[model samples]
Target: MSDETPIDFSSVLASAVHDMKNSLCMLIQSIDQLSQSSSHQSKEQAEELARLHYEASRLNTNLMQLLSLYRAEKHQLPMTIEEHYIDDLIEEMIAKNEIYIEKRGLTIEIDNDEALAWYLDMDLVGNMLNDILINAMRYSKDTIVISTEIINDELHIHIQDNGDGYPQEMIDLIDLPMQDLNFDTGRTGLGLFFARMIAKAHKNQNKEGRIMLENGGKLGGSVFTLILP
Candidate 1:
């Protein structure tokens, strides 16, 4: 009689996600090289290649988030808090998706102070910001604004777009607990859940970080804010 515990499928899924993430990284690189090397192709071909690159990049980002969330649930995620300039972080994120932004004829406006710094897990926060920015670019009409401020002794980072705002249901759903999120619908739920978890991981003086989603900002569209104490 052989007695063995049942294998946890979740762990297997996590491992698969990690492998997929690595593969996607290579695939994105290849797509980038192809786009660059085949610049002399027809306009239609170029556009198609650009679309392929963007979708691959987005998928890679999603897989990374999924793997990180899995690690977080297992209490294996390590967060390193360090002092970093907000502007520097934003610049890196913009540069990362610069090609896609340019192809889409979109613009990003920065209103952050060059000297404003924060203590946070840069990798985690950067990933969250990049994902939010990528999603914003898809919905923004033309201009996307990235701003930073200090409000009520908490550091606030805002990403606003000049386009139709988020659907009312999504804004309402964010207020509920992550466990209550309906994953059967859209990617918004997963992205928001990951962002919320990352934000709440930071704490200081009994204050934890949080995120907010509101419509009707300076851009008259959707505004996403990350507040960290």
Candidate 2:
């Protein structure tokens, strides 16, 4: 008589995602090395390498998000809210994507006060913003702007692009309550859902963090806003 416990499929999936993330990190490093060493290669080859790097990096980011979501589900994700300078955080985000931005001929503009600081889980917020920035880089034709301002005693961080605005359906999906989001249909819903969860985790006196998706910004394109209290 075997009395073994049944496996939890979600936990197994999380384990798989962790393993996949490690493998992806190695692959990304290898691709980066190849890119740096192949400077003398042909233009087509260079472009191909750049494309490979970008896709791999994007995949790595998705894997990371998946792992974070799994941890959050299990209540294992750690939130360390601290005061961090807005400009410094934005600089790190830009630097992380500098290579891809250059390859795509994109410009990054920062409209944050250097001394402005915010209290939140930097790792969670940073990862969410990184994912958003990656999407912006993919869609923006030339310019992407990162801005922060305090609105009604809440911190407002906005990432706006000069690309075609998000589809009406996507905007609608984002506006839906997190419980109603369909995570299985596509990555868009899942990413936005994760972003919402991360945003909602930060709290203050009667106020909580949130995210908003809008179009027709200063750039006439899509805007992603994260508000924290």
Candidate 3:
């Protein structure tokens, strides 16, 4: 018999999930077009369609996180750090999310120094921000605020919302590594876990990036902070 074993099941599963994500993207586009063309007279139909689109978008986000984590664990993920203007990144994200925010009648305010530049993996950072933005969208009451600045030689980015904030249990769990699959808060905890992993991946010289949770911010909501050095 050959030395090589059968095909790896994990690899197969990852590939399948990747394919499904792409298909779901197409599905979302189709649904979005249909929803845009439909008349607003059918309230129930429009609400159902909106829900379907949101769920599909959420599934796509989860699949992406899974794939990225898989590649990261295998040391196959690329980390390409480059100097980028912080304001441009925030602007791009806001533009992409405008519709989602408007649909919920929420307002987002971004505060940052116009000249601040940072060296980091743009793609990974973008994904990390995307996850945070999605979480804020889901939990925020009416407003979201993102801010960035340099403090004590470290770059800090904060995403905060105007909601009741996270439960005490979740704040406590931020420091601990993810070791359980059974979540009691009805939250999957995947986004925070994924954010932690990405933050830890950003290292410079001897310093590594970190993520933290706090109860109070400008918005009086849960704050997700990422620090990179």
Candidate 4:
């Protein structure tokens, strides 16, 4: 028998995800070019392009979350703490969703200081914000808001939506310890789980980042909050 152990399927899965993400990047780029040209003649064609753009965006987000989860499993994801201004961070998130926001007549409000700086992994935090914003957009009626503040020595980032709010069962998970997420509920659980993992990775003075979910905000819907120390 060969001395080498059988190949792990997990590695294969990771490779596949990487390939998919690359393909998605190309597709997203093409869509971006199309949006810039802004020369669609027929209403149906415009709507179709919008639909494709939204799905591709969601797919891209899902792949990113998967990569984050894989990194967590291998204990290879590193958090690089640096001082980054809050204004730039939230604006980037808004830009990521701009295509959908414009096509759907959605409203976005951002509340953050231009000069406020925080130390955290900017990429991971951005991914968390994008994931939460996508989730919010799915359930929101029209308005979504991104807010940031420093609360009790932790950076508080909130993405709120004005929809019916999260179902009771999903809300219950925040109170309990992290467990095997149920895909049966139509929630991939990757976004929330990845957010929690990224938050936990940033530690300062014995405290770490955390994720919280609640209903009733300025928009009277759902609020996804990340606290990073």
Off by over 4 Å in 2: 1-15
Error of 3 at 54 (Å): 2.7
Clashing pairs in 2: none
Residue 119, model 4: lDDT of 88
At residue 86, candidate 3 shows an lDDT of 88
Better of 1 and 3 by lDDT: 1
- RMSD of each candidate? 2.2, 2.2, 2.8, 2.1
lDDT string, candidate 4, 1-229, tens digits: 5998998756787798889988988987888788778775376766666677879978877777777677778776666889898888888888887777777778988888888898888988888788788878878999999888898989898889999988887887766565766656554466667778889888999998899899998899999899989
Global lDDT scores for all candidate models: 0.87, 0.85, 0.79, 0.82
| lDDT against true structure, model 1 | 0.87
Q: Give the per-residue lDDT of model 3 (tens digit) for 1-229.
A: 5788888656886889978978997887887677678756365676566567667767776777777877777787778888999888888777655546656668898889999999888777887787778778778998999999888889999999988987887888786766753356543477777777788888888998998899888889989899988
TM-score computed on alpha carbons, candidate 2:
0.89
Tens digits of per-residue lDDT for model 2, 76-148: 8778999998887898888777767866778898898889999988878888898899889888989999999
Cand. 3 TM to true fold: 0.85
Provide the TM-score for each candidate, comma-separated: 0.90, 0.89, 0.85, 0.90
In model 1, the runs with Cα more than 4 Å from the true position are: 1-15
